[model samples]
Target: MQETSVTKRFNELFDKLEHCDEDEQRQKIEEMNEMINEMDEEEFEYVFTTELFNKIHEMIEDKKISLENAILLLKYIGYYKVLKGIRINGFNESSLEEKFKEIIYDENEKKDEDKNEIIFVDICECYFMLNNQFSSDMYPICAPCLLNVASSKEKKEEAQKKVEVALLALSNSSTVNV
Candidate 1:
């Protein structure tokens, strides 16, 4: 038979526990606590043995409860398979941030090379030097640092645009020697 997902099972378990009276909840917590105490992290993760599954199935059968409540009750037992789904299954958040930085750097390097623009201090570097913080290291800038750098960059761009427009207007107004 196809195995039900941990998340689906956990949701069912949560619902059942929520519905139970205090006495039932206390009993349920004790059962769950026992199950948790028996397993370490690795065992908890991969040791979803048939015995546990059968015990859950039996609980549903004995309770004559709806499938939802059974799931919830099992969830209350706290040994439900749903925990596997909630785990941080892949790369760490910091690794993801580093990957993002790589993409941004690749794009920026290409743009810089094409434009023949030698920026002595890129925004990342400027933010770091001025604030004594590493901004590009995993979008590592704090909120205040990001805001300050963003506003400064915006102001610089606006000034450059005004200069370019002024130069263009001056050339248009003046007669060329040609």
Candidate 2:
């Protein structure tokens, strides 16, 4: 079956990620990221569907796309949803939150120094925005990883600084709203 034009456009975008070399991958992903802002609201239903997300997840599982790029795609896709005030129809909120927990709160993943601390930070930012400015956990899921980022005082100085502020806000606000 022939896909709709919107699906095809986004598939092309994902394909760019799939096909590019390491040098060109970031640029292509950025290209797709920027294009998301330019897309009309009419296209969002197609763009943000569960099937689309499943495709991205499969791509990640298959090693067809890097986790960084997939997360970047999700972050911008999520921002566009929030900024446009459109909630995805039939999307399971818990499933997404669970996935977020797996990404952020994994103890085994946390022990690796090579793991991207910035992804933890970015996930926290994205969670707040997508959850209507609410933190998912009272203590926050990424707090352990981010706390280390702060306490170690290493290369991620900016990440460390952001973590401090986020933890403060997370602790203060999560109890009040929901």
Candidate 3:
């Protein structure tokens, strides 16, 4: 049987993600984000189905991909879902939150000065994009993680961007009435 366009594109993206180095993974992620952004609402909803989210989530949980890349992929998906006004149907919000919390609360991951800054930035963006879906009660669990990233002095050049994303997550979380 021939592969469908969605399947083909998803496989291509995932293949690149699995095989690439850190910089190449980032490039592929950016490309994937652009492709998602260009999709119309119906198309986006169709392509990014519950099964797709589950597959990606499983990859993250199984440690098949780096946390940073997984979060970046989730961030873009959340952003496009919000932008397109698409209602999440079969996506598992609880599992996603659990994964986010695990990554955020992992002290060892934060202790890595070389990678923690970008990881936290991506986490904040993920939270911001999915703010409406997450409860305000979850904010406390995430705020301290963001604070740690914001205060890190090793990456002075990227500090502002990190701080901005952290603030964005906090602001969105605070304002969520749901």
Candidate 4:
């Protein structure tokens, strides 16, 4: 697909993200969010390219983006995915979930880990949105995260049904229980 103006602008933003400090990175990502927010349905095609996922993975690996900003970007990915009603068996672009799983599971292993309930919730929301329906190789990673948040007194309110379906899917899958 030809690169539209939006994609070109997003590319420029991604380049700037590399040289930016934490505060600057946040500002750039917020700008990105605004750009996406302004897009019409048809313009979404430009911003929703595979390159977006690729850049997100690169930025994450390079530590050029914080977890909060990473989550912000993923929200748009999931949002556009829903808008396009696109679902397929394999994403074939990036194993984005593995990176997040590492972050989350690492936190899970820490002593006195301040479980950022919003992180877990946002991740669960994105996981479901980015997957093929509720099924993906992400089940193992997302299942635990979702289950954990589902038990939270404050954070569980929105994810009740998601937690249930993840449980049902977990029982049916051969993925070893965590």
lDDT of each residue in 28-126, candidate 2, tens digit only: 767777777766766666566656666666666777777777666776776666667665642334355456556766633566686666777666545
**RMSD vs true structure, all candidates:** 23.7, 5.8, 5.2, 5.9
Clashes of each: 6, 0, 0, 0
TM-score of each: 0.23, 0.62, 0.63, 0.62
TM-score of 1: 0.23
Segments in model 3 whose C-alpha atoms lie over 4 Å from true places: 1-11, 19-23, 83-85, 89-94, 107-118, 143-178
- For model 1 the local lDDT of residue 46 reads 43
Q: Which candidate, 3 or 4, would have the higher lDDT against the true structure? A: 3
How far residue 33's Cα lies from its native spot in candidate 4, in Å, is 1.4
lDDT against the true structure, each candidate: 0.36, 0.59, 0.63, 0.61
Clashing pairs in model 3? none
Clashing pairs in 4: none
Error of 4 at 31 (Å): 1.6
Q: Encode model 3's per-residue lDDT on 1-178: one tens digit a residue.
A: 3555654675589766766777788788888877776666666656665666666677767666677777777777766666565665445344665666566556335546645655655765676556455555455656676676656666565677666555555554544434
Model 2 residue pairs with clashes: none
> Lowest summed lDDT over 10 consecutive residues: which window, candidate 2?
169-178
Residue runs of model 1 more than 4 Å from their true location after superposition: 1-22, 30-38, 45-47, 64-69, 76-178
lDDT string, candidate 1, 2-102, tens digits: 32344334334434654576567556545544554454445444433334444444444566343343333333222222232222122122232233245
- The segments of candidate 2 whose C-alpha lies over 4 angstroms from its true place after superposition are 1-7, 89-98, 107-116, 128-139, 142-178
